[model samples]
Target: MNPPNVQYISECFIKPKSSADEDETKQPIIHLAPWDVAMLSSHYIQKGLLFVKPSSMNDQENTVQPLLEKLKESLSLTLAHFYPLAGRLATSKQESPPHYSVYIDNNNSPGARFIHAAVNLTVSDILSPVDVPLVVQSFFDHDRAINHDGHTLSLLSIQVTQLIDGIFIGCSINHVVVDGTSYWHFFNAWSDIFMTNNSSISRPPPVLNRYSHVLNLPFTHHDQFVGRYEAPPLRERIFHLSAESVAKLKGKANGECQTNRISSLQSVSALIWRCITRTRRLPYDQETSCRMAVNNRTRIEPPLPEGYFGNSLQIVRGIAKAGELLEQGLGWAAWRLREAVANHTDKAVREWMEEWLQKPFTYQLGRFFDPCSVMVGSSPRFEMFGNEFGMGRAVAIRSGYANKFDGKVTTYPGYEGGGSMDLEVCLLPESMRDLESDREFMDAVCI
Candidate 1:
């Protein structure tokens, strides 16, 4: 495929469409929760691009300007409910403290940046398999993609690129402020506002009280965490597991167990974990583990409201020896994954947060490579197809450079409600090459 040539058109700051004049006196400083602070060291922005092909008649009738106008208007209206996205990040002191804990200064209203561009390419050019790294580096805004200093943050920025065949709506959201679910919530709401042309009927008010349970922790811990670690060299690629493959994995996993059917997530994760352990050829006795990110919204006591928006997530890890994962059947690995997930009860989440508060600078150093660990992030359950944004459903979804770390993986559902999965796997070049050639792994993956 030919390299895409993109031309920038215009850029602007988008603020809330409506604001209350009398509410200017409200508290502007939103403190960071311990959970939120842990993400301050995150250098990669959660990047996603949605591809859509408008109907022929609509495509011919609506030019770029009209579509962009509608998007900006709808985005502004959507921001009114998710007001934190419009705010900026700042430290509490003049000079940075040990770990300058950051806060969202809502009073300043930094606003999200919106950009318009035109690319001399087609939807197929990207959707088709290609050098994913080159494509991501070319298309995304890497300069400000991740929060480096915690001193400044765009919070959210969006780019609407007009391709020859269709349009791509790419967005970069700061990880410290929101997770995948929260990001989609804001996006779907924006889509609703535009499609229905009625802000009141589009999205219900998001519950902002979700942060009330967060324990206030010092920001300096962010500096400590960032200072303590350096990322290893890594490469990323997207692999697809078809519905058939996923079903087979589940069946195989279930067959190995006397009872207890593993979930699709556990099945798939177990397959990948076993493959990675085999591909790396780790020693049988070497300890191996999978740290899976779990959503705590429903798991917490008196569960958070469905619309509660914030970073309500925890990392639960399953540990086993390398031999145990590779030598055993699929069910064994799946059971480990399931058990780790089961242990993260509401009480467990609360305890985890408290522990972080007590030792802000601590790191889960064991979670990284000696080539025996993988951190599984995101889930296939998120409704990526629902991010229509006034256009047709997205044909494909992708991750940004933020996922550039060894032993990191992300999963999204296959296209159009399919039960298949798209796994974004990042690892050291050698490990990736080995995994690519592993016959058993390659056989199950969509070619």
Candidate 2:
């Protein structure tokens, strides 16, 4: 399919309209935790959902204007609760103890960017394709901007694309401010405000306070964390695994191990790891790794509040030799992943935090560029299909061109609304072609 032309109609900044009575002169500065600082070099998180226009609207030609008005208005109300997004990242100029903070001076603040665009395409143009169209990347702002760019750029940017028969709402959020959990929390809250026509979110409001235990460390040599990341040429494809396939994988994994502790996620992660290793044709004795992002909300000594709104994640890696991984079958790989997750306890998290303070470092794109490794991000358990903003449930979900590299895999719940899963796999062009033709891998993929 040809790339559709996206005509930008207008753009403006949407400021937060607070519902609470507070002094604008003394807005608190939010401090960044170690987990948050670790993502400074990574790109902004870009995600969006596709919604069909409702049949209740009578005006055809004037529909988009009203929809844009409603979205912008509700976004203002949503930002009142998520005010940090309306601010920018500020760094202290001192050379000794580098300080990074999110500064929100309510008196004078640069608001989040809201863009309105029109696309001459249909819902089928996005959802019906075997591979997601490259044009989908245009639905979002801040194409390749990293989180560090928030120092000069908007911490949050939203784009609402009007299609012929649908709407696409995409967001680019600074990863230093929030992780995947917080990302979806804000999304669901915004949808709730719009759906209920309320000035405040219906769900429990987000806890904006920084974690108390994380020490404010003076991170040196911060120059490495600020810059644009240029990724290699790659191909992105979504592979679907139905409920039956997931169950079969779980059963097979557990059967091989003669235990029922292995979960559907671990099973599927193992399957992808092995398939990618085979497709890459790595040396038999080469050491390969699978890194999974684990949410640390529940893994800490004192659990964070229910809606703790910040980065509370840790990446746990499971390593094995290429030959052992492919030869031992699925269950062994699943067990290795399970062991990795189980080992990331409260003690481990605290130890890592302490170590990070001693030697501060951020995740660079090179860390994930290896064909012999896979980094699994996002989660199938997120409420991807629940963002109903008065139109209907989202028909599909898509992402932009940020933080994408070979061996990067993101998981989402299938739109089928079952236990089905969708894996958005990014790989080199040649390896992608090889994986698509691999019978063992393609057998589990649903059309």
Candidate 3:
């Protein structure tokens, strides 16, 4: 590629000829949250660079564009498939309307806000530091060619780049329409179809139906819900964690509190709050909350059919204080975390979701809470690592998007020399570094 030139491409507009006209056969890609769609556009346009190296014929360098177009076209056929992996922190209201947007909506960014995922192929011209920004900008700039109305629909910038030599493919999905697995299934299936010229072999039709008849919650009748976390001004640092440190935190928390059903994740999060409070050294009885994300798929009956893409995550928070969470050892915080998660999960959690599932788009989750809230979300339940066509089994796989909130946390079970559970974890950068530096933090989780 010539030394990249950043051009604000000449733009044009199109009034798709009576597109959604009286055509019953044509399904609308539902616009879950127009605000979130816009938020993702603004965020990804700034840093959504996911480099991909061509592997099989479908991903061959010369043919990437057509495949990209095809993927978007297919995805556009549903109402629930607009923005890719976007999430919202709006104050959670009394009801949970079809939550499908995958993105974070904090008004801040000092570090990158891209949603990076890899395809593990080797290719030339992987982006170098100086030019990374330029290449990343190109993907969003060319949105016109991809989806002209990308801005309007919250499906703006996305980068498809070559990583490694030609054995790996990196992709930064604009956290709008697709979440983690949705992108995997979408791209993998697209590759499967393109490689064979059939869009349906072993592919399942996407389930975009959010039937009102099914959501039988006693809603507050049009109660407007604002987001839980308001968009904060960009921070000087980006919030992301590496897999190595997450493992250590889990071990440290375990060392302190040896208990049942106590996930390493909860322990690590508790430790994070504890450490941050200590460093900041805040006062006693000062409360804080960790926004815990829960996937409602398995919890829901019939377990939404495979490939049923949309926002399926729900938030349950772990509450502790500036003094309590801060002063307590890892074990104490971990125990409290365990209780918080467990208490919400009993019988009340399901009913809570049932009701919250019917709220309006502006639903803010913060209205229902306390102090020092840290938002968190997790990657898919199980890794979707078997979409291989020719390259040997995947050697590595993990999420590329960061939580991006001031006190945000998100994780994925890392893949090392693994099977069902050699769990590797990632955390916000600062917290991870703290875990590595502090011996107490380190020993608490037994890292």
Candidate 4:
């Protein structure tokens, strides 16, 4: 099959419908916390949902154009609550070595970029294939932009592509500005406004205040982490785990460890880690790791508000020797993962923040590119298919071509909506082929 061509229709910057008090001349300059600064080296988080057009639109003369206008209008209102997303990153080198911060000049906000495009493919063209089609990458803007690029580029970019029988809404959010949780928060809010035909969002508004007590240091490592990352040739595939399969894995994990504490995520992570390590054929003595992004909102002493926005994540890892990890079976591996999460307590979070302040460093993608390492991102807990933007619920979810590397895994709630999950795994060409054919790995995967 030929790659679907996306023809651009129009492009515009959609600013917030409402601004801050006009009398205030100085806009708030939000400084980046240690956690936010750590993502300076990462790429934008690109995700999208595929929705089949509502049956009511079958008789409309112009379906997509009107929907595009509605989306843009609702997005403008949504920006009122998430105003910082419409702003840009600013840096001042005069401060000895320079520091980075988000400058929301509401009066002159650049606004989020909105692009309208059309593709000649159906939703099945994207969701039917075992391997996601490369053309799907064209649905998103900022294909290779990193979080640092937010300084010059739009902090957020939304693309609405009109498919033959459906529509795809793709968003590219700066990783430095928000993590996966906040990303979906904004998405849900936008959809709510559109679905209800209300200008104001009914959901919990985002809390924009920075958590200052955690880190009192300034972010001055701008130049140290500025560059474009070129990922090597990689193949991406989504593996589905049914609710029953997940339960079985969880049961097996708990039974082996003689405990019932291992969660479904830990069990799944353990399974992937072991499968990838075994497929890579690493040495028995090689140390392999499974890194998971832990949300710090609830891990701190005084938990940040559920609506608290911005980056508040810490990467925790479960490390074990390759031979021991596979030999111990699934339960032992899951126990290691669970222990990693349990160890990242409030004290551990604060200590890590303090250490980062003293000697600042950013997360380099190379650390996760290690063949023996697997990094799990995104979560099934997110409202993946719940964003009903007046049209309908999302039938499927997909990610764009940013930040993908070997052993990178993104988890999403399956469309079936139970405890089911979809693991979007990226790996080297050869390793992916081996994994597809590996009987042990394929046995747990649901068709």
The number of clashing residue pairs in each candidate reads 3, 0, 93, 0
- lDDT, residue 226, candidate 2: 51
The better candidate by TM-score, 3 or 4, is: 4
1-447: candidate 1 lDDT, tens digit per residue: 557667888888788766565246334766666666666656535556556656642344256678898889888888777777777777654334333446777767558878887777677777676336355444554343445443564677788877777777877776667777787787778777888887653455676653543343454434445532455767777888999998888888888886556888898888788888887888889998888889888998899888876678877878899987777888999988988898889889888877776786422333333457788888888767777765677877776666456788888888745699988888788888989998877888886
lDDT of 2 at 403: 85
- Total residue pair clashes for candidate 3: 93
Which ranges in model 2 have alpha carbons more than 4 Å from their true place? 20-26, 56-61, 95-108, 211-222
TM-score of 1: 0.88
Better of 1 and 3 by lDDT: 1
Tens-digit per-residue lDDT, 311-405, candidate 4: 99988999999999888899999999999999999999999987887887777776535767999989999997889787667888999999888
Misplaced by over 4 Å in model 1 are 1-5, 19-27, 55-62, 94-101, 130-133, 142-145, 148-150, 201-204, 210-234, 362-370
**Candidate 1 weakest lDDT stretch, 10 residues:** 361-370
TM-score of each: 0.88, 0.94, 0.57, 0.94
Task: Give the clashing pairs for model 1.
Answer: 99-219, 99-220, 101-219
* Candidate achieving higher lDDT, 1 or 4: 4
Model 2 Cα displacement at 32 (Å)?
Answer: 0.7
Q: What's model 2's lDDT at 154?
A: 88
